[model samples]
Target: MSWLQLKIDTTKAQAPVLEELLETLGAAAVLMEDSADQPLLEPPPGATPLWDATRVIGIFTVDSEMDAIIEFLEAQLGEQLPAHRVEVLEDKDWVRAWMDHYHPMRFGDRLWVVPSWTPPPQPDAVNLLLDPGLAFGTGTHPTTALCMEWLDSLDLQGKTVIDYGCGSGILAVAALLLGAKEAWCVDNDPQALTATRNNAEHNGVGERVHVFMPDDMPDMQADVIVANILAGPLAMLAPVMAAHSHASTHIALSGIIRPQVDELREVYGEWFDMDGLAIKEDWCRLSGTRRA
Candidate 1:
């Protein structure tokens, strides 16, 4: 299907207004990119809070109703956004174009990212199938990999786990296969639940992995809580996730860049003791036990 790519040009001061407005319009994916900087998993290193001009590109799937949606959004944001700057294109080849650039990535001692189209290697390594599609959290991404690496090193023998925002269910499935007794996964997206279920089955842990939609989260707690999601949501969900964590429970978090660590840490610090944090490339992951 074609998509309305709303490319908004704005000063640093106006970016947040545009961002908030776009979300109000229900943008499927809104990515703000620097005029000169390349795409990144996280904000660039030493990147100031809002230092430069940028193109806030918002992608919305276009259908028969999409024209109206675009018109409505244009009218809603036109005064604040440059309407002429919008670009309309058929995004059929977008993900395929990215597939070439992301063949397969290996993380730590175990965990190999084998795309759905490729056969998993028979390495002693843990095989993770990732076809992130649109919901994010592919095991190949640096942030996700960092979390998987931490899971690989943990002593998960017979432990219970909760994987919030469990895109593709890679972490929870890995925990079960790696020695955890069982796991529960929470995601608001039905597509992610399907993807997570499929990935768990592919890894031979489907039955043991419990999937939960946002409103239907299980009240049960666990020995560990893992979420590979953006820093904003991670901080907001810390209390709910930490409720499932005991004093000895390990909490693992990802999808945060280097700069956002302090803010995120401060949020989770109320319950979790941030003893060790890991960074790879522009992404970072934090791991710690709950404070007794």
Candidate 2:
């Protein structure tokens, strides 16, 4: 089937209204993206943030009356429609298209993050079978990749790992696949916890993988603790992270940009002997051992 894609460039204030209007006009789906390459800071819990310049896209059946929809939208706004375009979008297997581009990615020499649909390039290497879903961390982003590479370098055999902000449970599951005794995944989002659990099970390490929310996380020390979250939250959770660490525990923290390195170093240094600063593109990963 063919569809009509309506793309509109508008202010953040107008984006939500446009989405609602498009839905009212029988759009099958609506998506909003940043028109400008703006960096988005973490929003307060339960808040949704949008960029100053937003591009709103609406998908509708090709046979829909686009002219009537546009007229109604403009009449509702009491102004002419902003810069927009409508194009025919031929139907394609979007999932297959995505999988075609997302090939198996190797982190370090031995660890491979492979899509569930694809075969591992190195069958003997540590392979993490994953599919990008509702949660993040399929080992594609620089931040996640940096953390995965660091995990690859470690001797995780018989170790207990804690993955704070565990999106999709990639790090925790990878640790298990690499011979870790157990992995505990903690995230604030319920969806993330679900994704983590599902991914862990998909890799056949379900019994060894535990999922928890931040508030419900148990008070237990781990041999290794890895957190891939924004610098701000990383800083704020320093005490919580420290509470879960004992002397000589290895810790890896990513989701930091180059500019935020010094502050994070200072914050995490109090609990751990922070040292290794790995840079990938504009992102940085910090690693250290827990202080006595």
Candidate 3:
């Protein structure tokens, strides 16, 4: 069946309200994208980030009266609605369409993030088969790539790893594939926990990776710790991360822009000897060892 798609370009501040208006106006589904093609970096914990200029698209039945709906929208939204367009959309394999944009990505050497549908580019390398979902961290972002590259350089065999703020469990699973004896995947969001679990199962490392919420995380020292959360939370999580690390623990942190590196180094320096920063585009990763 064909669907009527209504698209409206608006500011980030108005996008949420327009989505609600679309729902109230009988929209079956609504999606939002960046109108300016700006990439949204990872937000602080508990925050949902959006682009400055957002394009909202709502779908409805093609049989619906669009003129009357447009009139209602005009009344409710007025000048705030900006401009809109309506088009007919024929159903197709949306999952395939989305997956088409994602290809196998390699990090460092011998580590690959392969979409579940695609064959690994390097069969001899360690490949992580993943499906993108509600959770973040598919290795596409520089933050995730930095963490994976750090993980690749480590000797993880027989080590205990902690993937703090584990989104999609990609890092934890990668550590396992790299020979970590076990990994703990911790995140505050339930969807993140679910996504991590699902991805771990997909990689056949579910048994080796344990999932938890921050409040429920086990108290134990880990040989390695990796967190790709933003700088704000990383600053706040310093004590928590330190408490979970011993003098020998190796730590890697990402999701930091260049300007934030100095502050992060200062914050983590209390418990770790912060190493020199690694740059990927505008993003940076900080590696350090726990202080004795």
Candidate 4:
């Protein structure tokens, strides 16, 4: 079925009201875009952030009465929208559209995170079968890439690994596939747990990849710990991670921007002799061994 897409430019204050109006007009879906090229990053939990100037779009069945819909909206709003346009939208597979945008991405020389729908370019590479979903760590971000490179360089045969703040269980699953004996995956989000489990199962490593919340994490220490979390939580997790590490344990830390490196270095310095760092596009991955 075709859709009637109506886009209107409006102030932030009016966007919600217009969206409601569009819903009443029998819109199947409503989308909002920023008129200004502004980004909404790290919004407060459960809060919906909008731009100062927003472009609201309403999608309706092509057969709907567009004239009556516009007339009702204008009468209820008491003023016409600054700008508006209606266009016929041919039906397309949105899932395929999303998949086309995310091709198989390689990290380091050996590892590749390939979407389930796309074939790996390098057939001989150690490919990780993954699907981009609610969880993070898709291998597109520099932070996750840095960690993957470090993992590829490691000799993890028969080693036990710990993935703190494990999003999608990418690191843990990758470690298991790279010959690690087992991996303990920890995350606070329930969605993350589900994502991790599904991804692990998809990769045939579910049995070896154990998922947990921070509070329910195992008491056992690991041979290596890989944490790809922000600097604040990384710093706060210092002692907790240290308690889960031995003097011989190797730690790889990412999700750090260049400017935050020195602070993290000082914080983790108390427990590990942090290596210089692996720099990639303003992001840094720090690796080191636990202190004796």
Candidate 5:
């Protein structure tokens, strides 16, 4: 079955209305993206921020009435339609097409993030079977990769790990596969917690992995802690992270850019003996050990 993809360029303020209108007009799916190369910074908690210049695309069946939909949209907005175009999308195995672009990506020497459909290039390596999903973290982003690499370097055997802001539970699962005895995965989003649990089960570490929301996280110090979230949250959560660490407990923080390093270091440095910064592209990762 072919699809009709209608693309409309508009401001972020108007994108939502357009999206809802298209959905009401029998659109199967809607996707909104940055029309301009604008950098979106960390949004406030529970906010789904969009770029100033947005491009909203609505997908409908090939037989859908494009003219009627446009007329309705224009009528609703009380003005002429914005810059827009329609294209025919040929049907194919989209999952396979997406999977083809992602092969096994090695983080450090032994840690590899492989898609579930593909076999690991090196069977001896500690392979993490993950795919792109509703939640984040597949070792593709620089922040996630840095955390995974740090995990790979550690001798996690018999140690307890805490993956705060755990998305997809990649870090916790990696720690377990790297020989950690147990892992605690925490996230604010329910979907993230669900994804974490599912990923842990898929990686054969469900029995050893625990998932929780921030408010409900139990009081337990971990041997190692990793938080791959934005710099702002990392700074704010320093006290919480410190509470979950004891003397000499290893910690790694990422999702930071270059300019935000000093402030975060100052915040976390109050409890952790800061280590050298790791940089990949424009992203940065910070690691340290907790002080007594």
Candidate 6:
């Protein structure tokens, strides 16, 4: 099926607001990319990080009835935005575009986020396959790396873990591989549940990994909670995730930019005494133990 790939070009400053505005329209997928960040740039000797001056956000899968889409966005910020600003591009290969580029990637030591089409890592890494459809959680992103790295450092022996928003079941499957006794993964998307199930079986942990739909959790507290969701959900879930802990339970959180560390910390600070944190490429991972 063909999808409409609408490129709403805005200044770096106007991009976020526009992107958020597009969400109220009909965006199946939305993303912001820096125009100045050259895809063709080469590494340089002791060079400064590249600065992005322009912003491009893509909104996908709209119908011929984009009048509503246009009206909704324009209604809110029509005067502020550039005239004739919405440029709709046709996506002839939307599926292939994501599949071709979103390949398996390694997040940290002994952990491999293998894509569905790619062959598993050769011989030595802890392999975790993923199929990220519309949902989230692939280990290639730095936020996922932070959580995986935190999981790598811990001794998951005999622990029961909960992976909230278990997109692809990456964390839950990894927990079992890292020696957790068992894991339960929860997601609202049936597609994600299916992928999680498939990935668990692929990783040889299906028998040990239980998949649950949202609001249907098994009512048992876990020894560890790993949430790789965005900051908004992570903060909203702070109490619920913490509730999954007693005294000795561990927590690993990611999907937050470095600038927002303090907000996430404040959410879980009183409940957990932080163990340590990892920073890589502007993403942060935080882990802690729930206090008694």
Best by TM-score: 3
Global lDDT for candidate 2? 0.85
Measured against the true structure, the TM-scores of the candidates, in listed sequence, are 0.63, 0.71, 0.73, 0.71, 0.72, 0.62
List the candidate 1 regions with Cα displacement exceeding 4 Å.
1-101, 116-122, 131-134
Give lDDT tens digits, candidate 2, residues 149-209. Answer: 9999999999999999887789999999999999989998776898799998999999999
Residue 179, candidate 5: Cα error in Å is 0.6
**Residue pairs that clash (backbone atoms under 3 angstroms), model 2:** none
Query: How much does candidate 2 score in TM-score?
Result: 0.71
Q: Model 2: C-alpha RMSD to truth?
A: 6.4
TM-score of 4: 0.71
lDDT of 6 by residue, 1-292 (tens): 5566555556645655666676766576565444653321211211221223444444565454556666666678766345334445554544455576677666556777776667876547777766553334566666666778778878888999999877767788888988999999987766568768888898788899888886888778999898876777788888888778889888888767778788788888878886657787877777788999
- Candidate 3 residue-pair clash tally: 0
Looking at model 5, report the run of 10 residues with the lowest lDDT sum: 37-46
| Cα lDDT over the full model 5 | 0.85
lDDT of 3 by residue, 128-207 (tens): 99866546787888888999999999999999999998988899999999999999989988768987999999999999
Error of 4 at 259 (Å): 2.5
Off by over 4 Å in 4: 1-91
Q: Once superposed on the true structure, which residue ranges of model 3 sit more than 4 Å away at CA?
A: 1-92
TM-score of 5: 0.72
Computed on alpha carbons, the lDDT of every model, listed in order, comes to: 0.73, 0.85, 0.85, 0.82, 0.85, 0.70
| TM-score preference between candidates 3 and 4, better one | 3
> What residue runs in model 6 are displaced by over 4 Å at the alpha carbon?
1-104, 116-121, 131-134
Residues 136-225, candidate 1: write the lDDT tens digits. 456656776787888888888899999888866778887887789998999876756876888888877888888989779867879988
The order by descending TM-score is 3, 5, 2, 4, 1, 6
